[model samples]
Target: MAVVFDKPTLLQRIAPIFQGFDGPLVFAILLLACAGLMTMYSVGFDHGSRFASHGRNMMLAAGVLFVVSQVPPQRLMALAVPMYVVGVALLLAVFLFGIQKKGAQRWLNVGVVIQPSELMKVAMPLMLAWWFQRREGQLKPLDFVVAGLLLAIPAALILKQPDLGTTLLVVASGLAVIFFAGLSWKLIIPPVLLGMVGVVTLIAMEPQWCAPDVDWRVLHEYQRQRVCTLLDPFKDPLGKGFHIIQGMIAIGSGGVWGKGFMQGTQTHLEFIPERTTDFIFAAFSEEFGLVGTLALMAAFLFLLIRGLIIAMEAPTLFSRLVAAAMTANFFVYAFVNMGMVSGILPVVGVPLPFISYGGTAMVTLGVCLGILMSVAKSKRLMQS
Candidate 1:
């Protein structure tokens, strides 16, 4: 047989590109990709075309993963500031003449309609990492303030767009970068306390402060309803609260053992809303029970732990910040979606990350993972 040098193998020959692969990181990605495929199958059981679309998206994500893992961390650092500036400008464009759907304008149209906020999810951490990298030996107290400003500007815009879920995710991701970059616990404590107080105050004054007569002209009507519904879903079960009520029922009905795969009563009966998106975890719990849930959580934990180990061993501050932020984003995504599904947190329409069915989110997360892999690979190559 003649030896043939094909595209894939020939492409793999580049030194800096695909130099040292991370096994654990790759395993984590594979697990999430599998979970995505399984959940999408259920989500689009009636509409098989969705499964095909998801497959295509996964293929694209994998390609992105490969391409991004090849880029050197130093190069990624160089690309950060420019990318962040572009992201912010796109967000401004969105605010000006974005597409409005369900009374919220989060998507912009330059050539195609897309969510610029998703780009921020990747750009924010990159920018912060680059900033911290620059101030490596002499990180001042005021540096945190500058980073806070970097995070807050776009977060405020996203929040005003009333895309509460993504705004919070982006904030969490950016803060993770700062935290990993050696933010002090003393500095972290005050904000933690204030956030708790704010939550309590919101809950305490849910009726008056969140009432219609308060002239909620600042908030879109549906956003107000979502907050109110989070406080008490029973107030309007048939209206805004329907999704939460149904999701909880589906989850609670699972008991010790699940009702079995594809045999969920609530799911089959069409009682569970957004079963393949934010509420997919609830549906999975309904079908696979406690055992399945634990297995999934364990996989996520393994991924997080391995990611942190990689961050700790990274060759540079930028790599460490990028790795840690990506890991924390995964944690935040899982926590928020599960919290919302269980009715512990307000519904803000954040997806279940890999398990959810959205091309934009899947690709954004894929890119995040790619950055993590790049960091991990750089560390390994230096050691080798």
Candidate 2:
């Protein structure tokens, strides 16, 4: 008795790849991506090929997301150490021989110009998570000390490139992993309190500290200027303060209901600086108004909450740490960009997650979302 088995159809063959994906997370991403496209079209309409280019980047990012999501968490854990090593080696190479653009030596040229600091954003968390996973059941004070050393080395290297923004992000992601790995609150409170005190002291002494002749030894001259400008943008109105002032005007002009898409005076009249890049949040606010901004923030909040849920449900320590750290990355990106544009924080050249225009950043975002999806999928599969 000869029996024949039916071959799987294309849909059936590929079904496992799509199986176990978290629906709410996917919906949140889609909602943000749509908002990003609409906002880009409005802001980039007259800004050469930005709108088309942005759409292309989004497609490329989606491809990345799909490809990365297919990889299981165990594979990601295995890749962590090598990725961190390669990223750190590239950073050293950039330090030795890198391309200088706008007075910063941050880009390295192999076949193409690449910012090594950007790679650290993902690598730092991965490395720390891998380290903690290795000592999962029996972690010690020395383990955390070793993790801090790992984080500090790359952070110090990037800071030497004078890329403060990327350094902040890398440090934040690494720290998030450490925090989630069961570090004691007793060790965390002092530095935070000291930081708060330092901030208050700086604000109180701004007049003296920002004096023209005063030179801050720890900060580069441009960095010092940024802090001073943040303290009082009106002090240099048309000089260092131009970006912040213009951004605030655009945001305020949007009113409660917005000026309508493409009808932003500050945006179209060219009053806003970097209208399609770092300051796109201002352009978005100008055209969409308060209501639109709240809705956009809500989408971000949804993504953050969903990511946390996924992290908590993740089966392994590596997946949990990675998910939480990646979620922190998104939060920092949005908070820093919005804070700078609103004149509450210094201009640090951070971009709004989906709304900002940058191919590299878009690709990085795709990787983050993919990791989250992988973790979420792993949890569901284990349950089933």
Candidate 3:
């Protein structure tokens, strides 16, 4: 007697690739992606291929997410040091031979024009997580000092590029890792308090400090202008304050319910600057209104909470640290972009995640989601 066996189907072969994915997390991402597409279409309907370009970028990001999610956590850990080193080296190259655009030298032309600082956003967290994982059981004060030095090197380099937005993100991600790795509140509270004091002092002295001939030595002239504008946008309503003023108007005009999709006067009339990019939040607010904005924020909050839960459940220190840091990155992106658009924070060119149209930023967001998925997958597989 002979026995026969049925061959495995293609779905069976591909099933493993999609197995172990976190369902809630995927749902959250889908919600954001759908929101992004709708917002993009409304804002870019007549903006010369922006809608098509955004769709293409999103598809490319989906590919990046799929490829990255397949890699296990251990493999990601292996790539940490190399990624950090290469990222830092590329930033150095940019500082030396980078292309200058609009008074900032942040892009490097290495076969393709790339913003190297974007790379550090992931690398900083990965490197710090890897370091803490290596010193898991026997952490010392000096270990944290070493981690701070590791973080500071790349941060300082990017800050030199004068890209304050990216610098804030990289620093925030790195600091998230440090905070999760058991840094004491005793260590954290002082700097935060001092920062609060500094902000208060600056607001109190705004009129005097913003006067002509006031050269803010620590900040670039444009950066100084941004701070002053944030304090009082009406002072230069037609010049330096145009973006903020327009953003605020669009947001405020979107009363309780939105003006209906594609019916935003401020948006279609061209009052909102960068309507499809940095200030997309304003465009979104205009069309969707306050109700839509709250729903959008709720989606973000859901994703953020799910990510933090994944970090807590991760088996290894590396996975936990990386997950926490990446989760914090999303918070920073959303907070900074919304705050700037609503006139509370200075405009720093940070894009609203998912909704903003930028290829590099979209790809970077994919990588972040991929890492979270990888970490979540690893935990589930270990249990089974």
Task: Give the RMSD in angstroms, all C-alphas superposed, for model 1.
Answer: 3.4
Taking the tens digit of each residue's C-alpha lDDT, what string does model 1 give over 60-113? 888887889888899999999999999999899888988999878999887888
Task: For candidate 3, report its TM-score.
Answer: 0.99
Q: Judged by TM-score, which candidate is best?
A: 3
**Clash numbers, per candidate:** 0, 0, 1
Kindly state the number of residue pairs that clash in model 2.
Answer: 0
Indicate the residue-level lDDT of 221 in model 2.
97
Off by over 4 Å in 3: none
**lDDT tens digits, residue span 208-262, model 3:** 9999899999888889999999999999999999999999999999998989999
Deviation from native of the Cα of residue 245 in model 2, angstroms:
0.8
Runs of candidate 2 exceeding 4 Å displacement: 1-4
Clashes of 1: 0
Residue range 186-221, candidate 2, lDDT tens digits: 999999999999999999999999999998999999
Q: What is the C-alpha lDDT of each candidate?
A: 0.87, 0.94, 0.95
lDDT-sorted candidate list, best first: 3, 2, 1
Misplaced by over 4 Å in model 1 are: 1-19, 215-219
Instruction: Write out the backbone clash pairs for model 1.
Output: none
